[model samples]
Target chain A: MLGFVSGIDRDLLRQFERVSQQMERMMGLRGANGIRSGGVNAFPAVNLGASPEQVDVYVFVAGMDAEKLDISLQQNLLSISGERKAALPEDAQVYRNERFNGAFRRVVTLPEDIDPDQVNASYRDGVLHITVKRKEEAKPRQIQVN
Target chain B: MSENKHIEAQDQENSAMQARGEPESVMLPPVDIYEDANGFTLLADLPGVTRERLNIQVDGNDLTIEGEAAIDMPENMDALYADVASTRYQRRFTLSSELATDDIRAEMKDGVLTLRMPKRAELQPRKIEVSAG
Candidate 1:
């Protein structure tokens, strides 16, 4: 039943993908143990925004220390990686374990080239805020309208 | 590098607002609860929430955890892409009488809240020594 597609292939494929993803999220089965190998809607949802001066990326990751976080930028792709160690006491009996702990990665492709030196990252109240200034040449230049 | 990126571009043209009569959505933050010989340890993920904004209360065997995240967006900036949704965190747990609710210790750091609630003296495991015959 998964071999051939004859009519309305694109629509069917889109529907199927949406349904499957929703099911995975509902079942808490998404993400590769907190490692995102370049897939959309991966672990640790993020917000990306770009201003005239810089590009900003905010990732929601709690229970991680500075030593556990590793960030690097190569070309236009910015990578974020970190690990959240499990917080369980010794000889403890677990009642509920809904939160996920371990390694996680998130990558975003910027629209314009950013100066690697101008990148700034800060961790506050459990959120990691990253800002990369836009390159001077990449910013829009407006000529006097004649 | 052909990995899938989940970032979605935020639409800037359409400025829609929630209805005034509608109630704000409350998100149930994920948590882990573990019980040990002395007490229980609870860890909850509450990103973007400050210590002042987070509140934990226990009353009549009911434990409630709530936090509000204040994400201040700069006026000069515009959202180009977004995947994470902003939400207020809330969760409630019914505690057993065997647990001591008065001396619960709570701490928030790195966006995680850890709560240590000790069990009553009678609830904790204890070994009794037998007299030699």
Candidate 2:
């Protein structure tokens, strides 16, 4: 390994290291849709919003078939997995390639106060919307005046 | 020299406007342009854009596609883990003279927009027959 490392030019090795670091920073800093991913940068960009009674989760996954998408909930973690097919024809010559197409998995940790049984999800125009109702006990309660 | 200086000043003013957030941020949506026997096909990834808010226009040889995504946020909701943000989708494509720009067809489904630009009748291939004289 040391001999192999020395075989490459020092300047080339330095450039490679710099590029790798830059790639790591890019993947770590931004989420799928260029938003600030809190901790993990998964394939599908996700947004988690909550209301007083429920939590709403939105996943940005374009060109995905509805029947092929899979969503699972385990404890406080929600996993979304699916594949996006290439849109161009096989014989066509590609000019610009930027869209990503492959099997992807995104695991998001939801709030613990959510009710697992009451979770509902829907897909529209390529965005997956998931709504999980919060537990009654977790919601704010009004106190009675004696 | 005066005209060049005037152009430089205009460029500086435009950049200043961008820095001040006066101009909307434009994102380059990933796109794939393919050419085949027919003409050309363009596929763009535009997530969260609904049909009602999507628009496609063709002027001369320039084609423009724009869509607005209105992300539904619950009242008093906070983002615990956020990655994707709602934004407008805009892109432009320049067509060659060989293509029939007026007959271009566009369709949006599952957040992916597909545009088919057919070739002109004269540009299509035609087989010729030869006879011995």
Candidate 3:
């Protein structure tokens, strides 16, 4: 009887492991919809806001050179790409490393009403702010009642 | 286990703080620490943080880093979507006695903080010259 109970416990543990593996894969797939291509955690997360005149995008990234950043808009898709170089010397002994260091690209889908030619980007305090003006026809107008 | 030496992260305290019902919960920023023959270097990523908002304090053997990220929202703009929840960042570390706390230098640029903590003169390794008698 004891042997049979132990066998059941082992089976349960294996099933749990399989479920967790599937969950991880699902997370990777979900990332592809918006922020990243195929990764559990997205790099340089962004926030989007819109006003009547324009749309704003804020990207959070630290320790990056402004000249090296690449910001472009093709149709309604905006892509931000750059590389974060390591800070420490090659011979130094690393104790703990939690910061993300490498080349990364994040694509964001903008609204259809935005004018791609009027987009402006600026980097300040390690935050990238992109402002895209709305099309002239897309702007809301206050019509007078007859 | 043997590799875990020098700086010790205060993870238990972080969890405890989260348990309490604080009005503004702090998020720990990711960090990278490395050691050389003379001292240790620490790098922390603090996006959206300005120089005036950053605070660093060292009391006894404890070192703390705290900062507040300012999210700029224009007057006429309304947020359509946001993923970042917290703007406060805090992290603490227990530093070893071998480090020279008084001589520590800090610099912040592009929202990243770099700290250089050198070893005390007496604690650093020294080479002795041998002569024939």
Candidate 4:
């Protein structure tokens, strides 16, 4: 047998909502086709930091190719450009399409003084990693306090 | 006024139906991309797509997901709000060689499609010890 609760129950409802959303994410991954709307943009999540000597920029760009990517730095802005291509099997019928594929370009700005010439770029798995060494004048320094 | 509005709406709906080809399949849902310490997480919200009809491919730097979203009913069945949409999906990402090609992993749970790409060890930072006098 099951019992019913009154609509006045707030805390219990909140808990139920949280659990339901978590369960939805878990269940969603199993059969997710793609997004619904079209106007959404993909911004690669990044982790960047800088110290006295270097600046690091990391971008999450999976399902992409390194060769197809173009990276450049002008002033404080870093630019990234690439394209996504899709292929279909002969007998397959398309009913729903949610994934984004086509031309993608993203620009990021750096915070510290870096040697653009000394910057290093690499890609592992699907993530793109870039590191730039800061110029001597831009590095933080401490003056002796007497 | 209501009559004119209704007629305009009807004409618009009819044209929409005609353009979309009788709505044989539902449209695909939107997906979100999240990146973290490990790598990238791709989530796709596919509602009625069956595993049998799903097709995933990664060639060179391109990745594509295609499948049909079939709405099958058992005997006497009815449907309501939130219709499912099915269409072909083809996406690609150009990868860099610095990434270890052997470590990409993918999994599907519920109706979400997740693809994980771990960061390579060489790409991660390493500490260097300084010699002291």
Candidate 5:
């Protein structure tokens, strides 16, 4: 024991050091695709905009593979499901892990009526871009009066 | 006061024996530092921090990354299963003077934290035109 170490001070420092080290191993934050989670939607960073041509949806999901992606459309609701595989190596011993794994689902309400059949989704560089074509009936038709 | 100090010294000797080594590892989130035309982009791994829990403070050129990571372990489980009780991370980095601290922006996705520090207008490359008489 160092001369400066006191029982109370030693315990306090031990806890502080433990906490500080724990802070170092947080691999990443846990998040859901779109649904409300713990009072807050995982990202809540989706951009909401509707134009005449198509509806563009950008969902941020880094470190995820395309094979694990699942997108479904129910009426005006769009649900996305996938998983982010842990980045750790299989053979390595894990001292600590902070990233959430398993399953995730997010449901987004479409701003405009969309043709589910014509929707297209692509995942590239960690972002899931979904293009939902607007239904013909939902598009504005210019009407001329005499 | 002298008596208390003597007792405390003895107590410290015991504590020292209990805690004598460094933590296994001092790992941090994956960070990518890039310099672009606009400014610098810092991408860090911040697994358990939510937007509300994230705190960013830039005073002068000192950049601080402070955030709380809440663990998701259930309380009622008596049986043991594989687990990693790791949560919480904090780190700090110094910023360049050319960066616009006021215009810095951060966004988190999945477990990655992206920080964009835009360069000040004065630091931007501007083409100068010469008048021909």
Candidate 6:
């Protein structure tokens, strides 16, 4: 009887391992598409805010040329993509490296009230600021009592 | 040459904070260090930090980098979402006697800080010529 119980336990453990492997692969597929999976260690972290008139997005990235950054908006989806060159020389001996390099893209979905045609972007001090104006109909108005 | 005796990174508080299960008050910026025949180059990514807010100090053999980032929020704007908590960045390092601390060059551009620390003139690698006797 003990031998049969142990065999059942081994089988259950193997099933758990298989499920975990599949879960890892699913997460990897989501990360490869540059979609924010709410991972704490995502590259080029961002902060988002909104006001009555406009929405603001703050992207934090360093050592990048502003002209090379690509920003586009389709409906309510905003995409920011760019490539960061390596900082060190090819022949130099490296001691430590913690910086992110290579190509990176971040996609953010905005609210439906945003006006895609009224967007402005600016880069300053390694931070990119994107502001999108809200539609006139979406603005909050104080209703007067009759 | 086998060991890193010239420069060593030190961050005791950051580790202690993690151990104590407390939130970090200051952020540790990512860095890259590379060595060449002449000297060592240190690059740090300090996003949102401007030149006027950055401070670098070398006291004895201790090197410290401190900076503050200002998040510009327009008046009467509500922050719907925020991932970054702290805007302060700080890191420390210990330098060896072989480095020329007095002659270190620093440059800040696009929220990145580059420090070039050269070796002492006498400690630089030199090639010896073999002459026929």
DockQ per model, Cα: 0.52, 0.63, 0.53, 0.03, 0.03, 0.57
Q: Evaluate all candidate structures by whole-model CA lDDT and list the values in order.
A: 0.79, 0.82, 0.85, 0.57, 0.63, 0.85
Could you tell which candidate, 3 or 5, scores higher by TM-score? 3
The DockQ assigned to candidate 4 is 0.03
Off by over 4 Å in 1: A1-20, A23-41, A141-146, B1-23, B130-133
lDDT of 4 by residue, B1-66 (tens): 999999999999988988988843434445655444445555564433455656776666566666
Model 6 lDDT, full chain set: 0.85
Candidate 6 docks with a DockQ of 0.57
User: Which residue pairs does candidate 5 place in steric collision?
Assistant: A28-B46, A28-B47, A28-B48, A29-B46, A29-B47, A29-B48, A34-A106
Worst 10 residues of 5 chain A by lDDT: A32-41
Candidate that beats the other on DockQ, 1 or 6, i.e. the better one: 6
> Given candidate 6, what's the lDDT at residue B10?
28
lDDT (tens digit, per residue) of candidate 5 on B28-67: 4445566756777776666456777777889899988866
Q: C-alpha displacement of A127 in model 3, angstroms?
A: 1.1
Query: What is candidate 4's CA lDDT for residue A135?
Result: 88
Indicate the worst ten consecutive residues by lDDT in candidate 2 chain A. A32-41
Distance from true location, Cα of B104 in model 6, Å: 1.4
Quote the true-contact fraction of every model: 0.95, 0.93, 0.88, 0.05, 0.04, 0.90
The TM-score of predicted model 4 comes to 0.38
lDDT of 2 by residue, A1-146 (tens): 88777778777889987887788679766544323333333567788888879999999888888889999999878888888877557887889877877788877878899898998988888889999999999999899999
Clashing pairs in model 6?
Answer: none
- Distance (Å) between predicted and true CA of B114, model 6? 0.3
Q: Which stretches of candidate 3 lie over 4 Å from their true place?
A: A1-40, B1-23, B128-133
For model 3, which pairs clash?
none
Per-residue error at B51 for model 4, in Å? 22
